[model samples]
Target: MPKRIQSSGRNIVLSVRDFCEREKDNNAPLIPFGNVRQRVAAKTGISEKTLNKAPTLSSTKAEMQNWIINKGLSYLPTMVKAQLYKIIKEHKEAPIYEADQMLQAHCHKVARLPPYHCELNAIEFMWSLVKRRVANKNVGQETNNIVNLAEEAFQSITAEDWQKQCEHVRHIEDKLRERDVYMDAEMDRFIIELNNESDTESDSSSEDSSDSDYSSLAIHMDHAYSK
Candidate 1:
């Protein structure tokens, strides 16, 4: 729900704030400047100072907020973010040149980034699929046989299977786009309802609130093979 605007002289912050307000859904997380800093510190394990020096991403608070609100949300878990803070803070006392190097190493280990990418994410989907297909029975008692089973499975995927998978991805992408549009429209409708209810407080209004709750992509992503 957060967006980045060029850090405008006076108007930039306000525009960002206003956009957030207009578009915020009932369940949207708050995206204040202070909250963003705290979240970043929690995610990177680096001191705010060290995070400031991060080059892969811009350091501006709005940019950070936008990145997290959009891209990072799927990758970084709350627990992981806290651990990142610990790793960076502990390593910050090292000499300047060494500090960056140490922090970078720690970051790769700490940052979960995207939980899934193109459905290939090991934890998100593929691992479970493999387990479901093969885990119940041992491939073999010995290591070599297990490796052979894995290689055989990898080689089993055929052209027809790949075509079906591509079609499935396209269908998923279309559904996701529809869901986003529905959620956005729902937010606007909810706000309008809220305004109407407030204005008609003295009168007994019986209209049912419109149900705009379309399932979000997060739920789709989180819901893989359930244990």
Candidate 2:
């Protein structure tokens, strides 16, 4: 958490560690911070000593190395378990959501967007519209005026616009899901074709080796007869 202090009439600098200490001094509820190892151990009921022994398992490189050492298993169940524990720990100890819950009485259901899919959030489009309006207003006279203009831009977005954006997001979600299904089907087909090709190649190689062996045997018999 960074503390923003007004140095001279709106010119502010952020001090992260100092701000946290200052907030602590002010009796602000300190954010809950959990260690990765401890969190994973608690979630999975795995002993901390075991986790410490495989500390590198928390990392992708270490997971990949473990996979290689295990002879290239398609699925490393242990690695998956470790990753799940890490994910659970991260979600449980998220600073913002945890703080929000502590400060607010109302139950918050946080719906997170998929990674790199900001377009799915209608608020993103609404903000773009608001920023465009603010830029057009050219409220550069004062910071206060700029703030007012931005607020005005935000207020200008109608409920209809919000509804439309929601509808668009729904449509995009359906399309994305459809695309995922198509991709999964294509992947399955590809794997089947690959396996068939490999089997065919193996059969061809076996036939070639058998023919070579037969030819060698026939030549040896002819030599014996000639002798």
Best by the TM-score measure: 2
**Candidate 1 TM-score to native:** 0.30
What's the residue-level lDDT of 50 in candidate 1?
61
Model 1: worst 10 consecutive residues (lDDT sum): 211-220
Clashes of 1: 5
lDDT of 1 at 129: 48
Instruction: Give RMSD to native, each candidate.
Output: 22.5, 16.7
Tens-digit lDDT string for candidate 2 (14-33): 33344456657978533334
Quality of model 1 by C-alpha lDDT: 0.48
lDDT for position 214 in model 2: 48
Q: Residue 7 in model 1: shift from native, Å?
A: 36
Q: Which residue pairs show collisions in model 1?
A: 42-81, 45-84, 45-85, 45-88, 75-113
Model 2 worst lDDT window (10 residues): 216-225
Model number with the top lDDT: 2
**Model 2 RMSD to the real structure?**
16.7
Error of 2 at 177 (Å): 0.8
